[model samples]
Structure formats: C-alpha cells, structure tokens
Target: MMLPTDPAQNLAKLIRCPSVTPAEGGALAVLEDMLKPLGFAVARPTFSEAGTPDIENLYARRAGDGPHLMFAGHTDVVPVGDEAAWKHPPFAAEIANGEMYGRGAVDMKGGIACFVAALARHVEETGGPSGSVSLLITGDEEGPAINGTAKLLQWASARGEAWDACLLGEPTNPERLGDMVKVGRRGSLSATLTVLGRQGHAAYPHLADNPVRGLMTLVDALLDPPFDAGTERFQPTNLEVTSIDVGNPATNVIAARASAAFNVRFNDTWTVESLQAEIHNRLDTASRRRKYRKDRKEPVEFELAWRDNPSHVFLTHDDKLIGTLARSVEAVTGMHPALSTSGGTSDARYIKDYCPVVEFGLVGQTMHMVDERVQLADLETLTQIYRRFIGDWFGSR
Candidate 1:
C-alpha cells in the first residue's frame, strides 16, 4: 500500500472537493482514504440540532501505548466569491508562479494536508510515533458551528476519548511560515440591541420619537470607555458594530424601531457574564441621558438580545507543548516564531476545554481572498515542522 507522503498531492486531492460549509463535498471521504492506509480506525459521525444543519465529523485514531495527541481542523472552505475572478479555477488546484491556487489552499485544508503528509512520512520512516494520534475534523466550522467542534468534542469524550495535548491546524502565521504560533485567543461575544419608538412623519419631529437617536446613544456607549487597557499577555478588548438596521425604506418617515448588532473580541479582563453586565449598565445609563431624547421623560425603551454562545478567552500554559512546537518551527524556518494570542476565534476555543491546545499552520496572507493560494515551498516546510513537532512531543512525553 502506498502512503500519502507528499503534501502537494494530498492537498490537490482535498482542494478538488468543493466542501463548502454544510456540505461534505467528498473531502472527508478523501481524508478517510488517506488515513485508512496508515492503520487508523476511522469513524464518521453525523451530529444535528433542531435549528442547525446536520454536520458530518471525522475521528480517526491510531492507538498506541503513550499519551494521545490530536490534530484538529475543518475540511470546509468558504464559498468562492467570484469564480471568474480567480486566476485559476478555485477547485482545480492549479500551480502557477510556484503557488497552488484553490479555495482552501491556506485557510484550513492546506493545513490538514501538510499534517497528513507529515504523519505519513513519519509512519513510513519510523513506524509512527510511540504515542497515540488522532484527527478530529469537522465539516461545520464555516457554518452555524452548532454541530461542529464543541459537540464533536463532547461526543468523543463520551466514548472514552481524551488527549494530553492538541495542535490545531489553523492558519496562524501572519506574513510567512513560522512567523507565529497562536498560544491563546481572546473571547468573542455578539449581541443585538433594539430601541423602540413611535413612527411619524420626519417633518413632524415633535409628534414622534426617533429610535435611531436612541440607538446611536447606546452604540456610542458601547464604543467609548475602551473596554480595557492592553493586558500583559493579550491586547485590549475591542468591539465592532457590524450592522445597524431600521427596516424602514421611506425617506420622510421615522422608523418604529432601530437595531444594531455588535461583536466584541475581549481579553481576559472580563468573563461573559461580567461583560454582559457591563454592557447592560452602559445601555441603562445611556438610555436615561437626555442628549439623544430631550423630549422624552422615560428612559429609552430598548431590548438586548445575545446571539449564540459566547466564546470564552483562553491561554495555554503547557510549556512542553508550546516549547516543542516553537522549536520545531524555528528549526525548519530558521526564524523563531512568536507565541501570539491575536486573530479571530477558532475551534481551538472549544478544544481548550479538553486539553491544552496550540495553533500553527501555513502563512495566512491569502486566506479567504479571490485568488487564495499557498506557496509550494510552504507545504514542504510546514510538513517538516509538523513532523518534527510530532516526534519531539511524543518523545518528551
């Protein structure tokens, strides 16, 4: 049997699968074929919730006598914005100017490919590591996330699965390979605030209360008072107002309600509950301010609704895991990687609850762009880095 030892070949096979969110697109099947030949016992479990699309996840374990290590990632890719805008077909895995162009070339599928190739090379040369290894892959990372890593982790743990450490294959490098390894991540919280008012003609300002004014007051409160000064290990908490809507199309009428949605990438200075309380406090105080509505005696009539689950902040303290991966990157790329906690939330937020997790993968410069591509040289370098980390992590354990 031939092993999947070539990173480029493994990546090409995966990119050919158009596994957009909520769609399998044969990506997991391709992965299964690669793992089966390497002595793994693979399980494809589908999870579902009432409002979420059913998700297919893969858990392939190659059991050994030592501590278990997990490689977590998603096979799904974001939709190609404009297929015609790409230099090469998004799913064709065309090679041009020493880079491979495809939808998932860097955001994630490329990371999985490099890791698989690294493991395959390890198996062929050293009969694999002395410890256990597994891949926890999900098809719903780019979707609603209801049936993805969080549920998959719970399901795996229910069946007596555990890990000493995890290396999430997310694109962590900002500029070049080995430039960064994410050791922690800030929390994520999202909510929508709506202000209620009476609708009337815009010219008759005294006859109606403009909810847009109240919404602007609340939004200003959320934006000001900067959540916190920069923390020692993390950046300052920042909130972004994503959308403000009134649902009113008329130009000469005041809308009955105005709502604004915002998301916060917060540091460890606050928990989800505390943050919620703070926001409520801000809105409460701002609602009573007469600056926006001097005509009204009562506070601004408003409601706050939180969206989905809030991702809590986390930082890994496992020295061995961090040191081993850092050394591996430096050894391969000759540049000491920075242990960072910047960037958006990922599945690592869920995995951290189970075991200490760190993220490292290809450079992420071109992820989610029209012509998403990865330098061919990066595939080889990342494979070597992952291979070295695997051997060192298991050997140290």
Candidate 2:
C-alpha cells in the first residue's frame, strides 16, 4: 500500500500502532516503509540485555559525502492509564475540535511525522542536501532504557556510522510551537540509608537505642545546609527524602532498624563521585558525634548503598547546530526560541556522549494524558521548522 505523505495522516498511522514501551507495535515497520521511498538505507537492530526485554531500533541513512546530521526520537508511548477515560479512543487517532487525538500525538509521533514531511519536502525541493541525514528511532525510551539509545549508538559505531550532530524530537516546547529548545539537563542520583538499633519496651529507655532519633538527626544534617546557591544555567542541588520506614505497628515496642531513601537533582557544582563522598562524610561525622550508646560506648550502627549510576551533567555547545535550529524556529513561527536546560532527563542524555545534541518538538500540554492530541496546525508548523532547519544546516556547510 502506498503511504500518505501528509503529516497528519502519517501521524495518525503511527498513533494507531499502540507502540507502548518495548513493543514494536508495527511502528518501526511503518517508518521503514516511509523511509524506503525517500532513498534511506534502513537497518532495524533488536538490542537486548540479561534483564531487559529486547528493543527494536532503527538507524537509517541516505548515503552521501558531506556533514552527517541525525534526528532522534522514540516510537514508543506510555500506556493509557484508563482507556475509558478518553473522549476518543487512545489509538483511534480521531479528529475533533480542530485537533488530532491519540497517544504519542504530541510527545512525539507528531515530531516524527513532521520531520519525515520536512525531509520529503527538502528532498523534493533541493534534490537532497550536500550532506546526509539519518533517523534514530527507538522503542524503549519510556522503559528501563537498557536496550535503547545507549546500545544502538554502540551498534552503529561498530558499523562505522558516526554523526556530526543530532536533533532530538522530544516535546521541549512548553506553551507554544517555537518557545523553547532543551540545551542541557540536571544530574540525578538516589541512595538508601539504613540505621540499626536495639529493640525493647518503650518505657525502658536505658535498655534500648532508638534508631528513629539517629536517622532523623542524620536527615536534618543533610537538609539543613543547602548544597549550593543556584548555578548560572541550573537551579541549586536539591535533596528529597522519598521514604522513611520502620515497619513497626506496636505502640510500646521500639523497632530494630530505620531505613530512609533520598534522591538528589544536582547541578555543575559536583560530580557523581564528589557528591557521593560528601554524603559519606556527613553521615560518618553525624555518627561520630553520637558515640556513647548508653553503656556500649559506640556510635550508631548504619549501612548505606548507592542504588544506580549517577546521571552525568552535560551541556550542548555546538554553535552551528543550536543556531540553525533556533533560526528555523524563528523563521517558521516568527518567535525567538529560548535555549533551556531546566527539565527532567530524556534519551538525549545518552546521545550527548556521541555528538552535540539539542531537543525541539511540539507543545507538550497533552502528552501522556487522557485523549492526548495535537492541533493539526502545530504539526504543519513544526514540519516547516524542521524543513527549514534541514536546508539551513546542510546548505550553510
């Protein structure tokens, strides 16, 4: 069947796939069919790890000689919370009130649709650019991320495919079509702390050590002094205690151990190693000050474990890439875009390691929500923006 070249129809077809994380749902197949006509040589690699389910990702390129540019996004969508909550079906791709409704419509099957349209138009108009363009679409962006961009990039590198720069089609704009582009993201880390004590009757204070008291004191020490004043482009490092538990339900019995979990969203002032060391110092110092345990003469007993790899902080600094995308947005929408680094992380975190990357896409008001949809006009406008960006990026070089 011949696919529709119209951006809206193409997006509706993608939305119909129901490509919730780790599932192809025929979304990648649709993309392969679309790209074949555009002369891109497409490769679908299904990457896997021990614990994570295998994910299918696409790497397609139009063979050429000049600077290589890549556009990256996910075909996956988060699950629809309660299907009955939607005014229209989640995968129906229904149009009403001047908007197209469905999952991934705005957060970003719409992005994929627009970019394909832009590329199709660019190829038709200029007979292809001096350089090459490629697409990196993954099916695991919303999952554990074990088998997604991190592995796909490695696979591509093994085949000698390297990119000069990349543009991520995440929903970076908040209020309008051309209001923002994400330039960086703050780092994140999580840890668990457990403090041990003696269990005894509540009334017999002299016989038992109260771990709750020690845990509260340690938590206070970490929170009282702020990590740092805000950095130039990022907010200050902030710590949040997600949970505290003793698991004891009795009114008169003391618990044996208290556990607490906390997360930190930090800025450039600290690296993953330095921040971890600081946490250990504070905990050890707090433990030392409270050493005379009734009769034992020892500090509070505790254990700490770092849960996951710290998300490394980074900023995109390529002038041509950032400037071209910004200019494209302005030219299409007549609005200057803001280069921001103040949101949660995305697949771009991994892509940044390979090449300078930035994110620009549709307004994100309805993403991952009931009746998720996009205004038809916005899709066309975004396509125009990408079209202009593709022309400018390769034309200038």
Candidate 3:
C-alpha cells in the first residue's frame, strides 16, 4: 500500500468529514485509517456521563522505549454558522487561490494533518523514532469537555502510557505561522449573581424595590479595581459582565429580581478558591454600601453561584520542550515565535496536569470564520516544522 506522504491530502480527507462538536462524523475514522498504515495501534473509546452526551475519542501510539512524545488535538470543528456565507461548501475541502477551504482547515485539522504527515515521514525514513509517539484526540473539545481528554488520559495512564512532553495543535498563531506559540493559558471562571427584590408598579416607587439598581452596584464593585497588574507571562486579569437580565418587559413594573452573569480570565495571582471568595467579598461590600438610598428596606439581597469547572492558570517551564519547538519554528519560518499565555482556555489545560504541553499551529486568520481555510503552503511549512521538531526531540534526548 502507498503511504500518505502528502499532508494536504490528509487534511482534505479530514475536512470532508463534518465532525461538529460531540459528533463522531467519521473524523476519527479517517484519522485512524491514516494512523493504522503508519504502524500506530489506534483505538476509539467512548466515554459517558449522566448529564453529558457520550464522547468518542482516539488514542494512537507507536510504541518505543525512549522519551515518549504526544501530539494532542481535537477532530471536531465548531459549527459553520452560515453555509451561504462561505465561498465554497463548508465541508467540500475546496482549494482555491492557493488555499484549502473547510471548517477545521486552520483551527485544528490542518495542524493534525501536518503532524500525521511528519510522523509518517519520520517512520518511513528512520523506521521509527528512538522514543514513542502517541496522539490523544477527542471529539468533545468544542463541547462541554466532560468526557474527553480528561477521561482519555486516565484510561491511557491506567494502561501505563504516560508522555514525556506534549504538543497541542490549537491554531496558536495569531497572524502568521511561527508568530506565536502558547506556553500557558489564563484561568477562566464565571458566576451568576441574582438580586432579589419586591416587584411592584414603577409609579409606586415606595412599594417596589428595583433589583436592577442593586445588580448594577454589584457589577460596578467587581470592575472598579483591577484584579492585579499583568504578570510576566500572563496579561492582567479581566472580568466582563457578559449579561444583565430582569426579564421584565413592562415599562410600569419594577422587576422582582435582576441577574447578571460575569466571567473572569485571571492570572496566576489567584487560585479558583481565592478568586471566588474575592468576588463574593466584593458583592457583599457593594450590596451593603448605602450608596443606593437609605429608604430601601435592606441591602441588596443577592445569591452567587459558580458555574462549570474552573480552568486554572498555568505555565510550562520545561526548557528543553520549549526550546525545541521554538528553534524548530524559527528554522522553518525565519521568525521567532513569541512564547505567550494570552488566549482562551483549551484542552491544553487538561493536558498540563499529565505533562508539559505547548501549542503551535497554522495561521488562525480563518479559523471558525464563514469560509474557514488554510494556505496550502502553510500546510507544507507546518509539516516541515513538525518533522524537524520530532527529529530534534528524539535525536537529542
């Protein structure tokens, strides 16, 4: 059988699969088909939880005795919001004007395709690396990540497979290939603050308490003081009031309750517990401030509830891992990629607990856009970088 040497072809096959979040959609099947030919033992496992949908994941390994390296990514792409807005069909894998158009073209699948090609080249040329290479791919990344990498890693660990280092193909480049590599990510936490008050006619101001006023006060307290000065590796913490709701439509009625939802992207200065406590303290102080009016029956009565699993801030300090990827990117693109921690959360957060992980991938100029695509040249260049990094990683260590 002829081996798949062209990364572009690999990516096209992947893009053709409409594997939107939590859907198998044949994306994993295509990946397994490619990996099996390259001597990787591939397995697709399904994990389930009571509330969340069952998730399918892929774990492929080329076993060896040296320092193991893992490549992690997601096969599922975000929804292609509007089909008509795209130049070509979202899943057609059409190449026009030197770029391939598809949903996951750059955000991920392109990066994964390049890594597969690089690995294939290495295996074909050298038979195999001194060390092993494994891939941890999940379908739930674009969903509520409940039963994905978190579960896959535990399964791998149970089978005695742990990695020395990991590389996540998460479209880290902001403008161009090699412009950036994510070394860390800021933590994320969110909460819903509900303020309860008496509902009555707006004309009868004395009979009704306006919760909107109280909710606004709480929001102001949370935003007035900066969380902290920006850290060396992380930007300053930021909180945004994502939503404010009273659900009241009538002009003459005061809302019985008003709620506001806020999310914080915090730096390493605070942990999940400390940050939650700080937010509560701020709310407590603001609600009781008498700043609203002395005639109100009592301070704003509000309740705070923390949402989903909080992502903790983290930094990868492994010199060899960081240096290898940095040099590989520089060698290929002739640009020094900035080691940054300025981005939203990713599966990398879960991978960090098991091994040192970093992210570097194709230019993200089109990720999740109406016509998501990747330049064919960028695909080849990324493959070369991955090949070099693989050689440098196992060759040196």
Candidate 4:
C-alpha cells in the first residue's frame, strides 16, 4: 500500500473527523489506521472518572532496539463557536488561496498530520529510524484535561513503556511556521476569592458593610506589587483578575457577598505552595489594614478556593532534544527559532514529569479562533523539519 506523503492530505482527513473535545469523533481511528500500515502497534484506551467524560486516548509505537523518542499531542480540537461566523464549514477542510481552513488546522491536528507524513517519508527512504518512535495522543487536551495526557502517561509507564525524550506538536510558533519553538511553559494557578459582608438597603448607608469595597482592596493587594522580576528563562509572573462579581442587580440593595476570580501564570521562582502563601499574606495584610471604613474594620471575611489542577512551571535543557530541534528549525527556515516560554499552559506541563519535552509546530496566530487555518506551504515545511530532526536525532543517538 502506498503511504500518504503529503501532510496536507493527512491533515484533511483529520480535519474532517470533527473530533471536538472529549469526543472520539473518528479522529484517533483514522490515525490508528494510518499508522498500522507503518508497522505501528496502536492502542485506543478509554479511561473514566466519576465526574468527567470517558476519554479515549491513542498510544501508537513502532518498535526498535535503540533510544526511544515520543511525539505527544491531542486529536481533539476546540469547539467551533458560532458556526455561522466561519468563512467555510469548520470541519470541511476546504483549501482556498493556499491555505486550509478548519478548526484544528493549526492548534494542532496539523502538527500530528505533518509528523505522520514525516515519519512515513523517513521509513520509505531510509527504512525507519535507528530508534523507536511513539505517539502519545489524547482526546482530552481541549477539555477538563483530567483523563488525558496525565493518565495516558501513567498508563503507558505502567506497561513498561519508557521514552528518552518527548516533543509536543503544539502550535508554538507565533507568526510564521518556524518563528518560535517553546522550550518551556509557565505554571498556571487559579483562585476564587469570595468576601462576605452584611447586605442591606443601599439607602441605609450605615446599616451594612459592602463586600465589593473589601474585594477591591484585596485585588489591589494581589496586583499592586509585581509577583517577582521574573527569571532568566521566564517572563515576570502576572496575575490577572479575570472576573469580579457581586451578582447583585438591585440598585438599592448592597450585596451580601462579592467574589472575584483571578489566575496567575507564574515562573520558576515561585512554587504552588510559596505562591499560595504569598497570596494569603497579601490578602491578609490588605484585609487587616483599616483602609476600609473604620467602623467596619474586620479582617476581610473571605473564602478562598483553588480551582482545577495547577500546571507546574518547567524548562527543558537536554542538549539532545533542544539542540536537535533548534538545528532542524534553523536548517529548514533559515532562521534560528527563538526558544521561548511565553504561552498558556499545555499538556507538556504533565509530560515534563516523565520525560524531557519541547514544542514545535505550525503558526499559532489562528489557533482557537474563528476561521482557523494553516498555510499549505507550512504543512510541507513542518513535515520536512520533523523528518530531518528524526533522522539527525536518532542518527546521533
């Protein structure tokens, strides 16, 4: 059987699957079929938790007796919000004016497709690599991220699977295909701070203490001082107040409570524990200071709750992985890709615990946005880069 050589074709097949988050939607099945012909043993394992959806994950490996390298990504794409807003049908994979438009064209189905194409070309020309190659794909990356890469990694490890290094095919480039490569990612933590107060008629000015005033003070405390000056590899830690809500619509009534939700994308200088302590310290100090009305001076009666799981900050410095990928990008694009840690968290945050990981793929300017698309040239360019990196990495190993 002739293996598909064009990454665009591979991507087209994937884009047509409509595998929106947590849905198998035939995305992984198409991949399994494609890899099976290339001597890969593919497994589709569905994992379940009480509250989350049953997630289907794909683990495909072609065996060899040398150093092992893994490519990690997700098959699921984000929802096509307001289908009418798209220029083309979101799942149609229509190509026009040298670009293909679809929901996962870049944010990552394109990366997976190009990797497969590159591997196929490598196998056809040189008869596979000196080392083994495996793909750790999950259908949960765009969802709660619960039973996805985290569990897939554990499941694979339990079965005696090991990897020397892993590269995530996430959209790391900001503008052009080879403009950037993510060497690391900042950690993310979210909190909801709810402050309590006595609710009463607004006309009765002295009857109730307003919680909004207190919540504002606490927020100021959190943002006034910069978290830290940042580290050499990471940007300064930033805390954004995503939302502030008292949920009171009445003009005359003072809401009994006010809640503000904030998220912090921190750097290596702070761990989750230390950051939590720092937040507590700031809130405590702000609430204790008699900055509010003197008569209502009481420690900000607030409840703080941490949100979903936090992603830990990590940087990969392995010469074999980072060095090889850098060379590959420079060779293909004629520009040295900037090694950056400037982006939202990804599943790479989870994989970092098991193996050294880096991220490189198509441009991300269109990811998760309406009219998501990728240039046709980029698909082939990325494929060649992956092909070269594979040969060089294993050749050296």
Q: Looking at model 2, which ten-residue stretch has the lowest summed lDDT? A: 288-297
lDDT against the true structure, each candidate: 0.94, 0.88, 0.92, 0.92
| Tens digits of lDDT, candidate 4, 1-397 | 9886789999999999989988989999999988998889999999999999999999999999899999999999999999999999999999999999999999799999999999999989988997799999999999999889999999999999999999899999888877888999999999999999999989996999899888888999999889999999999999999999999989999999999999999999999989999999999889986666566756878889998788889999898899999999899889899999998999999999999999999998999999999999999999999999999999931
lDDT per residue for candidate 2 within 1-397, as digits (tens), equals 3433578988988999989998999999998888988889999999988988999999999878899999999999999999999999999899998999999998889999999988888777777778889999889888988888888988998899899999999999899999999998888889999989899899996788878877886787678689899788888989999999998999899889999999988888989899899888888887766533435457768898898757877888999999999999999899999989877889888899889999999999999999899999999999889989999999841
Worst 10 residues of 1 by lDDT: 388-397
Residues 1-397 of candidate 3: C-alpha lDDT, one tens digit per residue = 7676789999999999999988989999999999998889999999999989999999999988899999999999999998998999999999999999999998799999999999988888888698899999999998889999999999999999989999999998888888999999999999899999889998997888888888878889999899899888889999999999999989999999999999999999999999998998898888887667467747889999899899999999989999999999999889999999997999999999999999999988888899998999999999999999999989831
Instruction: Show how many residue pairs clash in every candidate, following the order shown.
Output: 0, 0, 0, 0
TM-score versus the correct structure, for each prediction? 0.98, 0.94, 0.98, 0.98
Off by over 4 Å in 2: 1-4, 289-297
Better of 1 and 4 by lDDT: 1
Model 4: CA > 4 A from native: none
Clashing pairs in 3: none
Candidate 1 TM-score, C-alpha based: 0.98
TM-score of 3: 0.98
**What is the clash tally of candidate 3?**
0
True-vs-predicted CA distance for residue 268, candidate 2, Å = 1.2
What's the residue-level lDDT of 350 in candidate 1? 95
